[model samples]
Target: MDEVLIVVGPDVVADAGLIEEIAGREFAALGVRGSVTHARDAAHAAELLRDGAVVIPGRSGEMRELIGRAAGAVVWVDVERVDGVEPGEGATHLHGRGLGGIAWGIRHAAHRMRHPGRRRIPYGPHRDQWGDLYTPADSAPVVALIHGGYWRSIWAADLMEALCADLLARGLAVWNLEYRRPDLHGWEATTADVAAGLAALGDAGKVAVVGHSAGAQLAFQAAADGARVTLAVSLAGVLDLVEGDRRWLSSGAVAAALGRRVPRGAQASHGRSPHADDETVRLYIAASPLLRLPLGVRQLVVQGSADDLDLVDFGRRYTQAARQAGDEVTYLEMPGDHFDVITPATPIWQATAEAIAGALA
Candidate 1:
């Protein structure tokens, strides 16, 4: 039996009743004997903290302290939009998302409890420079999942939860990576983190790297930089940075990621200009997968027909470019959306899983 503590803050926006209902449902679905307690304040939360207890702390001034007190895994939730806030050490952070965020936190905690073999390992000192590692009983191929959120700080590695669980079930070691986003840590840091994380997996058999959207760019970049990958999978990825910047895709997300536009009131620690410069162009060339052709590794480029038309174009063109560069490439374009490719139950994901297994075999 596992026990969970849901600590409510005085100013949280999430509905208490709904949160409780979702927590109960998640515990039941996992078939775990679980007891849940809703702690009313910081004092109550402190009292409930115990070894092996999963804690969910709602938005509050003392939320950080509460998370620090928890002896087991912690899932911290904040409904308000926040940027540049890191998750507590060994805790999963969900910010700017609504009640669904709370639900996800509860579900993640329950899932971790249900599968005790999974572990969180940190490769760097920064809070985001960590990964969730899941291993089967026997030796298996390795697959590293990098999530995408347009290189923004608000989004975290939770996006790849479904794929991580699915791959683990099929006897593959899964590394769900979390890295510093360009918006907060600088573009160079983001790239360096991915490379370092992959390098830490030394001697792992036949590693495959999978990235979605912005993550695709990182995966391709890592592969191009010689990250010991046997195969690279890009799911509805943003492959062309220069063209994406020209089209103002995602309202200039590319430029923002390249440090062309810093958020108001945030220091531009990377020393990038507000306008495009020669250095900016160089950055784009260095990061764009389309530009870094001849990755020299087997590549699976998967795109959904119903996703952003720009992404469809990028996938088609990038696949062609990679093939022309003499790299082994398999392009899979199907009917789905940007997210369907990552959802484990979707046909898109099933095809992706098959492709990955084949490539590793």
Candidate 2:
């Protein structure tokens, strides 16, 4: 008989039910009948995994110790912490490329990235801009990418071409997305472009999405499309709307794009914003994969340690919710910032490709 072990963090009151359910039900759903142990003590978990494969929702220091002792006992899922990189609130200066220039480069690179998605199939005169044929043909599996500028428009898609190329080599189609700035298009309109781009792709085979920073918010829509999406990868994904609402207000620059036209008299900053209309707030939460993750789709959240803008707990909360929602979730915690995962040549992309291929298979 095969076996699996699931370890949940000791939030005791909150995670108790989750631990029990995962230990019992999750593996059962995967068609494996085995003992599910929800152990608070990592030492005990290590002892148990010697019996069979293990599944852990979190890799705590204590759990790490136990796993290190008997790492072979577990088939641990990689969980990401929040990106520790503190992206500038506004346009930041680069040694050679200033903020606007960087933005311009991103827009241009997004334009040049268009190519055949696969070798055998012909990608069309697609409506979307960030089109690079991954398979040497067109429109195989559009990994439509959207960069995060905090809706600030400074961080464009220029820094991400490497990630796109890597996905293409892995035989996954790439769509490196660029959108109208908060200065020009506003958040709603920018997202509309995302919708349009996806629609333009015309329901290709299992569109798997990868979004970084603000794009992580957009990836939620791709995963939640409830379409034939295979998997959704969020690297330093911005999954919480409340956090975004506050950041938008504080940065002030995002008001141009994020539909954050501050109300004249509203003074509330915590819980929920007083100025945000029901629809707007709903939209923000809607874009959040954490709130909208579907049951069938697999989700991989890759976050960095000690990330500055997005908190680590935010990623933890997201994975926890997905587990509760009955979605297959894999989390990876690498040691890097928001840009680390997107560094095309980085091992992060390779790991991501492996995960994607596994999911697609």
Candidate 3:
């Protein structure tokens, strides 16, 4: 009985087929069925409202009116617009545009960095719970680089080897941290591994924690949860897990990682959640740095304009929230993509080094 009614505007009717195809794949991935219906006018959209969940790509006069009237409807916006519906209107937003080609370019560049000497140290019994120590000549300032792949098993700390080498070249010791992923291990297990890994670093005084994507969440949590970290660098971090889930970033990777146990359903499809009793919800809230503010340390959020939309918003909102909560925070928005912060060849990486240097000072 559940169906998705995608309403396309008159201007974009020509490309309705392509849009529908993409929408279908996305919906099917989430185990939901969606049907595309091009509406000639606002009246036609209203007539199709009762069909099922309605999807309106971007802002439209008709869609806006429908949003005001049908509060119970599961509305989705393909791309967020300035005149979009209010947050309280119960709608889900999607980040349809991305720089996949640019990201690939940066990934190849990241893979080309000169290999540096690294000492592997075990943090826990599991092979995934280990740290790669890239040391300078003397007892230099330490920077912990945490890699991100939406807390999934596919991404590991190996991808950050080049970045670690770059930091070592800059006369800073780098700790490329690896922890269990939520997909492979349970969320609690993964979070516990991150905490344990930080604890295993021993008395590494006042080190800076640099996290990218999913790692950003862990980095923030490590700092707030009593890691020996002085400064926290969130490089295009997914700081807001709740918002990340609603926006369906990384093709519902957040939802996939969270699994179906929590049953986010339509409640979480909007920005906030109604179910606080769910174990997954509890764990997410406990781990979310955005919800638990005032980390009590200097923080730098490095964001890229050309990065994934979810990451961009996460950086902006997290920086503002930290500052508002009386924590010293700096936000650096540069012209780059998601992987630029980790690619040594990019200017974003240089900026990140500068931020770490300042944090060390």
Q: Which candidate has the highest TM-score of all?
A: 1
TM-score between candidate 1 and the true structure: 0.84
lDDT of prediction 1: 0.79
- lDDT, candidate 2, 135-230, per-residue tens: 435446567667776655445554556676667767666766655545544566666666665565675777777777767777676557653456
What C-alpha lDDT does candidate 2 achieve relative to the native structure? Answer: 0.55
Q: What TM-score fits each model? A: 0.84, 0.57, 0.65
RMSD of each: 5.4, 19.1, 17.5
Off by over 4 Å in 3: 1-116, 260-278
Candidate 3: residue 317 Cα off by (Å): 1.4
- How accurate locally is residue 324 in candidate 3, as Cα lDDT from 0 to 100? 87
Poorest lDDT segment (10 consecutive residues) of candidate 2: 87-96
Residues forming the 10-long window of minimal summed lDDT in candidate 3? 99-108
TM-score of 2: 0.57
lDDT for each of the candidates? 0.79, 0.55, 0.69
List pairs with backbone clashes in candidate 3: none
Q: How close to the true structure is residue 335 of candidate 3, measured as C-alpha lDDT? A: 95
True-vs-predicted CA distance for residue 180, candidate 2, Å: 2.6
**Model 3 over residues 1-361: C-alpha lDDT tens digits?**
3555566655442355566556666455434555667777777766665423444533466555665564443444434223223422333232222222112212222222223246778888876788878888889878888888888664557567668778888888888888877776877787788888877778887689889988988899888887878898898898887777777878877777766433455243222567666677765666778876888988899988999877887888888888988999989999999878887878988987877887786
Per-residue lDDT of candidate 1, residues 140-259 (tens digit): 999999999999877778888878888988889999999999888899999999999998898998999999999999999999888999999999999987677777899999988997
User: Order of all candidates by lDDT, from best down to worst?
Assistant: 1, 3, 2
